[model samples]
Target: MAAAPRWRERLFALYFLSHIPITLLIDLQPLLPAGLQPPALTELLQWYAASFRDPLMLQPPEWFKTFVYCEAFLQLPFFPVAFYAFLKGGCKWIRTPAIIYSTHVATTLLPILAHILCHDFSKAELGGPRTQRERLLLLSVYLPYLLIPLLLLFTMLCNPHYSHTEKRKRK
Candidate 1:
């Protein structure tokens, strides 16, 4: 019998499952056509942007859009695979892919976090968070995307099941 999933594996499974809808609905909205986008979901995205003072979502720059595209094309596909693997537990096949996914996501978030912290939002007509408080609030929203992936990367890298393989012995 396979080992039951640990708490962290279950948590990661939940993360992957939750990410699927978020990607399809909110994260991929900027790339989607108005006709293709659902009205209620679009409203939810708009509400999140306004509430968070997220200029990146409100008026996405080319670079930010590129990131969203990657999320749609790449990470979106991986979510289901990861969800299955993590939920099943001890499937070594997931390790490399999980490592790659975590690294890519964590790398993408660094620049985004920096922009939130350092960008001169006031200069833009459609500005982002202008005050420190607003910026912090926005940062809080983006931070989990960074922190969780980093945690996954660390786990994948350090865990023996993920990092080591057993060799088959022949007579």
Candidate 2:
């Protein structure tokens, strides 16, 4: 058996650990701010509830058109392409992606965190409970945001050029 890279082990551990509170955050979505009700969070939980492996964006509210537009126009497809180049690309590009994604997460979660920290329930509650259909809808919408960085982090740890078995043999 090949030995694992320290970075890959670390990154995978971090990602796996993060899944817990993220799911909790979903369970507690009713407690988030109106302006940001966990962003793409609802979708994942809904998918789980419905026994779907992959969340699909169902019917979204007309008001959410802006989020769809912005996500499509601004963040999706680009961050990873850029991040992959940096992580797998060579040189020191990790800093850029790290900064950008950290900023993105902060901006994305700020509303809810602020409300919870600020103790403003009225401000935090986005609307109401998550209906089955609504949960499915939210999961689809938020999937890219949740799933993409995961890939970046995973890729950063794994170096295909160095097979795990080879690394072990060398050791």
The candidate maximizing lDDT is: 1
RMSD of each: 2.2, 12.8
User: What tens-digit string does per-residue lDDT give for candidate 1 at 1-171?
Assistant: 334339879989999999998888789889977768878988898889889989798689999998999999999999999999999888888888998999999989999999999999888766789999999999999998998888889878887767776789998
- In model 1, the clashing pairs are none
Give one digit per residue, the lDDT tens place, for model 2 in 6-117. Answer: 4654553454344445434553343344546555676655655345322112333343334444444454444444435443434234535544654564455443223223
Off by over 4 Å in 1: 1-5, 168-171
Number of the predicted model whose TM-score against the real structure is largest: 1
lDDT of 1 at 81: 97
Residue pairs of candidate 2 with colliding backbone atoms: 32-124, 33-124, 40-142, 43-138, 43-139
Backbone clash total for model 1 is 0
* Alpha-carbon runs more than 4 Å astray in model 2: 1-65, 86-90, 112-171
